[model samples]
Target: MEAWLDGLPADSVGLRNRGLAYGDGLFETIAVHNGRAVLLERHLQRLAVGCQRLALGHDATLILTEVTRYAAAMGEGVLKLMLVRGDSQRGYAADPGRPAMRILQASPPAAYPVVHAEHGIKMFPCATRLAEQPMLAGLKHLNRLEQVLARAEWQDSTFAEGLMLDTAGRLVEGVFSNLFLVRDGRLLTPDLSRSGVAGVMRSELLAQAERAGIPVWIGDLRLDDLAQADEVFVCNSVYGVWPVQAFAALNWPAGPVTRKLQAIARSLLDA
Candidate 1:
């Protein structure tokens, strides 16, 4: 399907568009069900934060309106909302006064093996590491070369997802999802203050877990923690949650905590 540029059907963006020129933009991948965008508020909240951090001014109300309308039209699928810094001249300095550009695209819902969700999956240990850029940390910006490279590290069907670490070798996240570990009835996830995308599903899980009286920890995580974890799972807005049964020689079961959170995530995505 063709994408909508500023709410109009378009085949291409301007050559000078900053998003095309230098990846100067942010994007959100949303799951739409029953004509509604799932976890829309959280997605918009993250987009707003990205705009603030990048100094890319945008009308939140306009985006919300457009996204709602687009999701309704889409019915059921994945909706991608991209906000760029508009067009710019032949220079690095962006036009501060220029209005941001909005691009929306819809695609069929993702298809993954049902067994992966039910029986769990194996994770590939990616050699590519995320760089610590505090300025861009936790923002789903257009520049995603690190994740791209990390994902390319695996081609085998056996590994459903790849685990990424920081340049300092601290576990950060999955290539396109958030990583979580359950130990002693407590939930632990890697800190994204220095690297990684603070995924929408990750945030939602943290909030829901806390509400359910689960102890949550957001701090540094390492391979040692993974070895000690009783349960491991990876989550994203698109796929909900997939329990990680194996990562290298280490193995974990789809323990109670993982199943509880998986059910919560399933309900959110299927809602």
Candidate 2:
């Protein structure tokens, strides 16, 4: 089966499902290599947190078992695990008694240009500002209208990503990934307490940096701060890491810290 809906062969959900109607759900994009899901634990951790925060009931063990079974069948690709509030009649209030819906899908991971990984890619500073919602901050919820709108701001092959800032004008993240910067031998990432998804790769990089004796900080960053950085990078679970060569007029080389973190990310995720 290419997809499973609550452990059954299915490719579509109902029209009234809360996930589709109101984006009452969460999802994780996992990389599968050699019949095993990479960073499965981290993905599940985030999912659990989302479920708790949303007051949605989910079986973590069941979801993990199904994900493993599904990924093994479609080895060496991307696996998306989606948890929805389940099918409900026309209403915003979810029924706590109803069981949650789980979706597992497998797709071929995109074959990115090797040069993009070797060197780096240019990005456009998106004009779409993210609205700060503390309740939804850091959770990879199904609601991605902001990112969709930001991504639509540009359609040029020259720009590989779009950098977005929160409504308060603090740097947030890339449209589809987490942002990081290096300056004076310290690693700094935008604080996502108000917006943006706290990506699994971001978490891994923070831990790895600590282990590698690199000082790391999570704080509010502005465009000027990013421009002053020696090196910058964007990361996702599937793409691993992409060094930011330039954003607007500012330019930066793929410095030592970025390269080191990139290597570490590959090793950790590919293991």
**lDDT assessment of candidate 1:** 0.95
Model 1 segments more than 4 A misplaced: none
Best of the candidates, lDDT: 1
Instruction: Compose the digit string of candidate 2's lDDT tens values, residues 170-203.
Output: 9999999999999999999999989999999999
RMSD of each candidate? 0.7, 0.8
Clashes of 1: 0
Instruction: Residues 114-215, candidate 1: write the lDDT tens digits.
Output: 988898999999999999999999999999999899899979999999999999989999999999999999999999999999999999999999999999
Listed per model in order, the count of residue pairs whose N, CA or C atoms clash below 3 Å is 0, 0
Give candidate 2 misplaced runs (Cα > 4 Å): none
